[model samples]
Target: MNQRYTGTAIFLHWLIAVGLIGVFALGFYMQDLPLSPDKLKLYSWHKWAGVTLLVLIVARLAWRLSHRAPELPLTMGPITRMAAHAGHWLLYGLMLAIPLSGWLMSSAQGFQVVWFGVLPLPDLVAKDAALGALLKTTHVTLNYTLLVAVIGHVGAALQHHFIQKDAVLSHMLPFAGKA
Candidate 1:
């Protein structure tokens, strides 16, 4: 077995991870700011980042579907393997859901989302303040969910590296490790 992910996979993994964390922090930071032109600008920037993230995630998913990931070691416990599988699937689901919820919220709030202030995107839902509020809440809730999942994901990676002494983490790293 290769015992390592493809270079493209590793690149997309880190790119998406960093982008998610950045957007999450930006989302929290922007929510409490007093209404002003700056706040509006921040919101637009946040939406732009979210849309970019959606694109990256879609590309990553397509790549993952087309390529085979390196297998876990034979020594890995079945329970651990199952947990890893579930964690990965949860991450994928949240990645898609979080941005989608944000896009829907913006649409429902009657805000047109323009990518980086360049290209305008279609609305996912009709303008409805009530629906906007609901979708906003959903977006916030999913953000926290994504945060927890990310923490757990990192913890598991550390556990695999330091405790399990396995190549699980290394598999995704852009470096050499024992197979």
Candidate 2:
């Protein structure tokens, strides 16, 4: 099996990484702004970006199911393999859940999600202040969860590249050599 992911997979991985980082930064910084038009504008960008991530993750998951991913190195320990699998699944779960929660929260607040000035996403729940508040809380909570997972993911990648001197990190890079 190839040790490096396909070009499409590599592209998607980096694209999502850059996008998610931008979204996270926007999310964090936007909250500090006073209630004003600028803050609302920032939130608009954040919301669209989150929706984009949701779409990309769904597509990535579909592609993954159809194609075999690059294999781990033969010398990788069982614990490492387990950790890798668990981390990936956790990332996948969070990626899907966070955007969904955001959408639901917005819908509950009676706002339609406009996807990058394109189609409007339908609401998943009825309008209710209490429910909206709950969803908002859930969204914020999941954001923190996502932050931690992302930090762990990045830390592990750096560890593999620097400490283990393994191709685990390189495999996700577009220029990585084939197995």
Candidate 3:
């Protein structure tokens, strides 16, 4: 069996990873900005990024469903393997949830999402300032949760590389070959 993931999978993974970081950071940076033209623009960009990420994640999930991932390292025990799988699923869930939460928050705040400033997305919920506040909190909380999960994911990959000295991390690296 191949030691590395398919090229398409690697591409989508990195693309989504980059998008996640950009959108997450933008959200953090813009949340406290005083309402001005620039802040409004930043918020629009953030929304666009979030919407784009949602599409990318759905595509990634579909691809994952269709394509079997390379097997885990043989050295990992059953419990470790289970944890890894659970961690991956959690990441996927957060990836999907965060954007939807943001979108719903925007909707509750009566702001329409315009994808890439071209396509306008429908509101997900009725306008309610209270609900908007709650969803904003939910979105922030989920993003931080994802941050923790991502740290764990990266740590596990590093452990595989440095401690186990396995090809696990290499499996996802671009242009990586058999170990």
Candidate 4:
């Protein structure tokens, strides 16, 4: 049996990872910018990226649900295995939650999300300043949570690859070379 993720899975994983990083960075950078056309453009791009991420993550989750992921390495301890499982689900949850929260915040702020300046996405919530504040907090909290989780994930992968000398990380590498 193949131990590695399928090519499509690998592609989606990397694509989303890169997109998340970009969106996160853009979100932070744009927040402090004085009100201007440039900031508005950045916000639009940020919304577009978030929507794109939402679509990709939904597809990724659907694929994951239908297909089994490789089993944990035999060498992994019980605690490590449990943490790995929980961490993965947490990542997936954050992946969905962050964007949903953002969508809600936008809707509450009475903003329309136009993806890539093309497709228009419907609001997830009604416009209300109070609701927008709450959702904004939720979105920021979730982003921070995601950032921490990603750090832990990277650390675990590095541990598996360098310290444990295991296939845990290599199995997910894009150019793993020779099944």
Highest TM-score: give the candidate number. Answer: 3
Error of 3 at 35 (Å): 1.0
lDDT of 1: 0.91
TM-score for all models, in order of appearance: 0.96, 0.93, 0.97, 0.96
- Residue 37, candidate 3: Cα error in Å is 0.4
Which lDDT tens digits does candidate 2 get at residues 7-81? 777788788889989998998899889999889888889999999999999988787777787788777899989
Better of 2 and 3 by lDDT: 3
Collision count of model 4: 0
lDDT of 4 by residue, 45-67 (tens): 99999989999999999988887
Score each candidate by Cα lDDT.
0.91, 0.87, 0.93, 0.92
Clash list (residue pairs), candidate 4: none
Order of the predicted models by TM-score, top scorer first: 3, 4, 1, 2
Q: What are the C-alpha RMSDs, in order, of all predicted structures?
A: 1.1, 1.4, 0.9, 1.1
**What lDDT score goes with residue 84 in model 3?**
98
Candidate 1 vs candidate 3: which has greater lDDT?
3
